[model samples]
Target: MIQDNIDTTTRQPIYPLLAAFAASCLLGTLATDIVYWWTADIIWADFSDWLVSAGVIVGWVTVIVALIEIFALRSARFRQRSRAYASAMVLALIVIALILATIDMLVHTRDAWTSVVPWGVILSAAVAALVLVTAYLSRITDAPAAIEVTG
Candidate 1:
């Protein structure tokens, strides 16, 4: 008797993912604008400043990595499956960075809610969470390879 099993390997909707990522990037930019509008301060006066800097850095990194993943997906030279996996991994890294940055910001800005809360931290956190969820979905869809077949 012959039996057939379902093929679990399936590609995700890259366009939606890309769109979401783009939206997040735009939101991050808007958050920066909001922060500038609320808090005129630029220098690192305390831990809050550092946290803001870290958040900015993470946002930038996430944007860059997301773009790279998009490019990888569009590349014709590489296998689609491999590209998907690589993209997922990069996205995961971006999410991790965003989470760390958010935690740092929340911890440092807890005392100055009146000042920092209006400065775009909430918007930034929302964007970060969106990126994180998408990244996690990508990771789940593209599981790591178990073995390497060398020629």
Candidate 2:
């Protein structure tokens, strides 16, 4: 039934938002790579450099997923599905951020950590978490009204 509701929406911006998020992440990562290449001797051969690269990739993926969820939540259709997706994305992003942060802390010193942790990654993760929490709470509040209307 919910699937049917989603298909009936006149317009959906979720896909485009997701695509934009992905593009932004990719651009950010590439920029990071280029900066690292120009400023330092690291050339993806070093283990720590590789780890930072991997973290950037994963962080971008998580942010893109979260943006998709946020777009879904704003959509007139598929509110429930949107909330679910947002919740899932939030959980996934948190886990990924924690893992990446841990790896960075253990592998790099304070100075290195400051250089390795991309601001884009942190911003995206934070936005995703905030959007997810807001959407989830709204969905929970609306559930009773939906039930009452249907019953």
Candidate 3:
């Protein structure tokens, strides 16, 4: 049974915002890769380089923030087994995405056309999928607010 007047306290998580930004920048590289492939444009490759670089940097920052959140709020956030499992899954996905992003960044360092055609695009797509999954999992895992009851 749920109470209509259930009292709860909410604290916003900062890592989700950072994750979204990193995901967007990383995912955007896929688009640029496609455009570069289609138009054979050097500019699009350049865009992919910058976007992937930024995405990788922010991805690392996101990892740091998540670690801080886990340690700082361990008692509040991971009390439930399922919540702990979900958080771990999210962290794993982020790490995987970071790895792909790093490889993609390296790929982007090559010549403009070769950099983005096959390998870069492939890595970008992989990272994009992981980021999407991470975002979705994080959303479902979010507790939103903690309920408190008083006698």
TM-score of each: 0.34, 0.28, 0.84
Quick one: best TM-score, which candidate? 3
The ten-residue window of minimal lDDT in model 3 covers 142-151
| Root-mean-square deviation per candidate | 11.5, 11.3, 5.0
**Per-residue alpha-carbon lDDT of model 1 for 32-52, expressed as tens digits?**
535544665543224344545
For candidate 3, the per-residue lDDT at 81 reads 82
Per-residue lDDT tens digits for candidate 3, residues 60-86, read 998887676666655454767887787
Which of 1 and 3 is the better model by TM-score? 3
Residue 77 lDDT in model 1? 23
Cα misplacement distance, residue 148 of candidate 1 (Å): 12
Which segments of candidate 2 are over 4 A away from where they belong? 1-45, 72-78, 81-89, 92-151
lDDT of 2 by residue, 1-151 (tens): 8865555453333333433343344334434534554566444214344444444555555455544444434434334775445545545544554354444433333244344356433533443444345335435644211211110
Comparing candidate 2 with candidate 3, which one achieves the higher TM-score?
3
